[model samples]
Target: MPEETPAGTPEGTSTARVGGTVDVGGLALTRVGFGAMQLERLEGDRDAAVALLRRAVELGVNHVDTAQFYGNGFVNEVIRDAFGDDDGVTVVSKVGATPDPGGRIPLRLAQRPEELRAGVEDNLRSLGLDRIPVVNLRRADSGPGLRAEGDQVVGLDDQLAVMTALRDEGKIGAIGLSAVSLETVRRALPVGVVCVQNSYSLVSRQDEELLRLCVEQGIAWVPFFPLGGSFPGLPKVTDTPEVLEAAKSLDVSPAQIGLAWLLHHTPNTILIPGTADPAHLEANVAVGSLRLDAATLRSLDAVESRTGDIVLD
Candidate 1:
């Protein structure tokens, strides 16, 4: 584990450091971290991308969540070009989705038992890593048009078999579930599910039960879209009155409030808010020190009118 220093905690952010630090599925990471999805959308400025990544590490961000599907494998390339030799950072990547010939992520079950090895290998090749510290089996079928009550948790036996085989072969250190339901998490626990990555926010509380289960079991609950993703035709979570009021009272951005709430809201929850801009990345990491009062947290929690659903399509 890297030693935490004063640089890790910026001045006047809060009395406590950036959500302190914790071990997520044996990978030591700061509670507040960066996501690499946005980096995929960067059209140019490769140097800016590298600088942004290095600055994130300088700000005490060690855990980075990414996937090969993002930008059709270009996101991992950004990570590799930026920190390919830096082992201090723990890079978490996902499997189960791939791009088509036209370079679009289609909705399909691509991570079957026979396909698992290639998925892991592809990630390894893209990120230039010997072994992925953590690999999430993203349930491709967990999105819209699927019945969460039934048939969503199918192929666990086969998926787990391949995951276990890869672990035994020393290709992956841990296995996790992404975009899955609470019942799917329950079914995945006995086979050593170490983390759960779901679309969770103050407005989107669909995964509340799943988050609680992760807390109780000491499993890492990584919430993507901490400020909400840009899903077409869905509501945004950042423009809420409660969040704005809390941001004014706390003298911080609404995005920071959302992140701080997630940090204060749970002990095991780890955030992976992504951005390609260097300044925004710093602001995101600074949320570790942004603290919220009890009343503000309560008010933010009680405002149901602002809450939205998990928009996973």
Candidate 2:
């Protein structure tokens, strides 16, 4: 469990925090943010999860990534229970999928336009809030694995139409995207996408083109698999020799170096590294302070990029 901290943000975290700032729908948030999915894995330990989340906010984390489908709305429940409409953190949730217990991947696509609206409502109900600050339309496109088929194959415009309606109605404050291609993002540009989440890391640079596009378009680049994934045949940044060397030299963990690299690799880049452990949560937020020198950056940049079989969304 994380060591408990007092609830005080803005003046508290911003005063001595190293996590830099980024704009999410005009909200200046810590670039190194927290992802709340690990709380879902702690099914039998709600208090510990809530405590950890509270600690994250106490440590200056104002941007949190979550999903109503995570633990079938249990994650958002944990968020509500932990923060209770706290405005210090920007609660960003995703649509386009729901939990599938005992299924192949534990998640099935919900890509229909109606399903999209229902997903937004599900987030609102779960988080105990009428307005979700930022919602990502997790399109079933550019699948690292999951794909849409039959009636699940909804068009971009169809999904955005409902998302825009929700935004107009104040159901969601802004919009984001995941598991998308450059062309798909280009098409969604008219709707004013605030951010784009994808599977990107030091080892996996396949989305460099998309990252550049986001930089040019002023969209926030929020990468999910910042340290890569645990899927078989997938590459992990911690397992790389260069990252291991950098950590040894800097007296930090390889995972920290991997995350720090992401923050330095591009502008408007935000990271949502999640953990169930107390120490790991603090370490994840501290990545913003880990600096990479020219030599370290060059060595890491020289390493080959590996997309592997990790999920893209």
Candidate 3:
């Protein structure tokens, strides 16, 4: 087993240091959290997936992100079977889609208020939880993946009403927003969003404004798809020349540099990189300790890219 860090109290957002752990959405999560989307591939041998999750917790990872539609609920089954009751992993799940085992894409938008509520119940039933620590309502209003159309275009306030109801009735601990725009986040602020999960990385800086807003509002910015790939001009994080150079200089992998730069760049940023391979899982978790220097940070910061219309603040 790899060395372990204390699961005890930790510091965050202080000027002097950006530690390996962060306090996000009333929960203390490691800066490097685990995303369970890839567990969909391990359905044939669920024990392996369970073992991987156990290993992640063994390596001091307490924050896990999952969704009900991943693997048509197989992922949640593994997550359900992975840990004992005392295992202290904070599970943050996403709603706005349901499992469609036969569809070309595994998930179709569950954007209606009722569908969002049912999504929460489905997650709870499969994960065997009465209350999830945090549940993100994936807006699908902007950015890549799963656009809403026709009647599926539910009003944001209507969705928030049901999510708020869930929180009130103790079905979810806190609310979060996923794949939303800066304006969308601003409009939802009155609902007391605890985190924002968008596609952000050193290579893709389109969401820099949204990220800054999250920091200013004391919201945890837990970025999904850490390697920014959806945009046309942005390079994959590991393929970026500066990131690769920094990785070589630091004696680490380019991916590690990419992940580490995120921690260095934003005090409130939390990462949830996912993988199905045990070795890859370990490496992703190990990024929590990969610290970059001032020179390398400056180099990564100065790396330029086109973000279509977004002007960086």
The model with the greatest lDDT is 2
Whole-model Cα lDDT per candidate?
0.76, 0.84, 0.81
Give the alpha carbon lDDT tens digit for every residue of 268-310 in model 2.
8988889899999888777766668999999999989876755
Using TM-score, rank the candidates from best to worst: 2, 3, 1
Evaluated at residue 244, the lDDT of candidate 3 is 82
In model 1, the worst 10-residue window by lDDT is 144-153
Per-residue CA lDDT of model 1 for 70-135, tens digit only, reads 777888888888885544788898887666544222434465666667889989998988999999
TM-score of each: 0.87, 0.92, 0.89
- State the displacement of the C-alpha of residue 201, model 1, in Å, after optimal TM-score superposition: 0.5
Candidate 1: regions farther than 4 A off: 1-17, 84-87, 100-109, 144-154, 305-313
Q: How much does candidate 3 score in TM-score?
A: 0.89
Q: Which stretches of candidate 2 lie over 4 Å from their true place?
A: 1-18, 85-87, 309-313
Model with the higher lDDT, candidate 1 or 2 = 2
